[model samples]
Target: MNKRAIIIGAGVAGPILALQLKKIGFESEIFESRSEGNTREGAFLGFTPNGLNVLKEFIDLDMLQEDCTPGSIKFFNSKGKQIAKLDTAYQKQRYGVETFQLKRANLNKYARIAATNAGIKIWYDKKFVRYHEANEQVTAYFADGTTASADIMIGCDGMFSEVRNQLFKEVSAIQYTKLISTGGYAKIPELSKPLDSIRMTFGKRGFFAYSVSNNGEVWWFNNYFREQQPKPHEIEKTLKTEIQDHLASVHKNDDPLFSKIIKNSHEIIAYPIYDVPKLLHWYKGRVCLIGDAAHGISPHIGQGASLALEDTVVIAELLKSHKDYETAFRIFQSERQARVEKVIKSARKVGNTKTKTNPIAAWFRDRFIGFFIGKQIQQLDWIYGWTYSNKNSH
Candidate 1:
């Protein structure tokens, strides 16, 4: 009998993993919580060189390139003073691939197409409720009262994963970083010049990042005011106050694009930054966790999406090369755990700077970051330089 795998959650990792498994001659079925074919609620995501390189094997790079903005990252202070600029193109020269800033909905659509082209069956509205693994087969139960059994189960079901909770009695608690993030995409009615660079401004109150995403939409995120919880529909309800306060404290004056983007945003999403402490083991028996479920890195380094992309390819490769699931699972954790832990730590350190509780600490943190901008970017070379080879490079 042919090997069959069932994946929960059809987000970045799940669908990408499905395609990779199909290439390795394994059959896969993806169960997603949302309804089919609707990739709305647009958001922007940056694909570092490492992410783009791995994804190129499964999908067309040209299609992805067609919908991305290739640019360098510019860092600045609260007074609109330039700090240090970093070259994203360095990844291309070092790794033979370029980083891209794309819209989240566009990337999701492309990954879905890749999975479908690989003949993977994806069922929508099949929210994962529970699962059971026997000696030979693993059975997954869904909230829709449907059940499917496969040889192995992989849960790519994002940060709040049902599969991870069902398998482990105590799920690793997500630590609240106290920082609230507000982001939305909108058209640039006018620009001082044609936007071609990504900019990040660090202020006393918080930080703001802006970049042009695919389809000529400007995507911006403001992170500040460590808070307990967000109000229901907080993005729409509190965006005006939040953006105004952020601008008032930082710039002390209104700018055209910032004001227009925040006021005119049709869909704004607000969420607190939560991270799971690194887990020692990512798999048990015939089941394994991937993406945010396995390791929820803070978005400070902008590596969450890239990490998910890496997890999908790594998990698929591990399953193909190892005969025994036990050995494969252990090796997978061993090989990836250190690298992921390092990234999680880096992201946490970065997020911590934005949330410095003490005034003195905040000053020191800002100066520290400004001083080491180049060194920090260089440290990421190990991550952006990684490649998936037929043989284990580690």
Candidate 2:
């Protein structure tokens, strides 16, 4: 009999992991804490070439494109002058895919649909509270006091995973990067023309980004610096006008586009940026972790969705190649640790650049930033150049 797996969380990572496992002859069920599957409250996400290629395993690109937009990228300074742009033609020609992006909710919808089409069942409202290791199976307890057992359990829960907390006695895996990310869907009424790509700006105080679709719809995000971590209420508070006014101040000297985009947003979503340092362990016995549950790199580099998809493909591949779960789990950690940590490191460096508030530091960054952005596209080759298979994930 094939070993059954229990996947926790029905977010992007959980559904993709389920489909990948099915491709490898393993069966699994996804348990999500939310009452239902899809919603439109979250922000947008970008999947680089490497990530999109892996997702192509079970999803059709055309089907996904219907929900989200895929395009190239251009970077600029606060003055609306172009700094450096990704050679999209070169990226597509070389990597077999370009940057594809959509809202987080839409991406989850697509992944869940794909998983369902492949015959994977998703249980809603099954909040994973904790787990217990048994002689031959692991039992997962949900918030409703219900339980389920499987030969293996994988946590795709997220950065603040309860599963991860249970695995380790103390909780030091997630570290705050001292940044608050905010974004929303809007209509850039003043935008003279539609854009088929992402436009990023590095200002003296914050990092601002926006993408305008061909039909005049806009999806934009901002990363602002906050010296200390916020309280739970602050993170959950809804203060659109207040946040927009603050953004107006931060982007006061930036292009009028920045302030206009902020004012245009119908609603704003906000969250903290955090990263998971390399863990001492990824799995033990019949339980393992994947996706953000294992690594939560900051989104500065736009690889969060892609890296999670890569994790699904690799874990499924490892299971197919190994005879037992023990070997599979061990190899999974060894193979994934190095690549993901590199992404985290790169994101940290770029993210810190957005937090520069000193006059001298801002001057130094703005003057020399072109050099860094020039090097950025070259470094992306290493990131978007990756290709994986169930036969050999590397």
For residues 235-284, write the lDDT of model 2, one tens digit per residue: 66744555778898998887877888788777687778886756799887
The collision pairs in model 2 are none
Most TM-score-accurate candidate: 2
The C-alpha TM-scores of every prediction are 0.89, 0.92
Q: What value of lDDT does candidate 2 attain over all alpha carbons?
A: 0.79
Determine the C-alpha RMSD for candidate 1 after optimal superposition of all C-alphas: 3.0
Best by lDDT: 2
Off-target runs (Cα >4 Å) in candidate 1 are 192-194, 231-257, 356-371, 389-394
Q: How many clashing residue pairs appear in each of the predictions shown?
A: 0, 0
Query: Residue by residue across 1-394, what tens digits does model 1's lDDT show?
Result: 6799999988778889888888777899999988886677455666888788778887787887676665577776666777767777667778888776777777777888888877888999898888888879999998889999999999898777887787675766777777766677667566323356788776545566777655666777776564555655765587546755565455334244465766666666566778775676788889998888988877777787788888877777877788787777777777778888898888877776665446676456457655686786778888888776646733
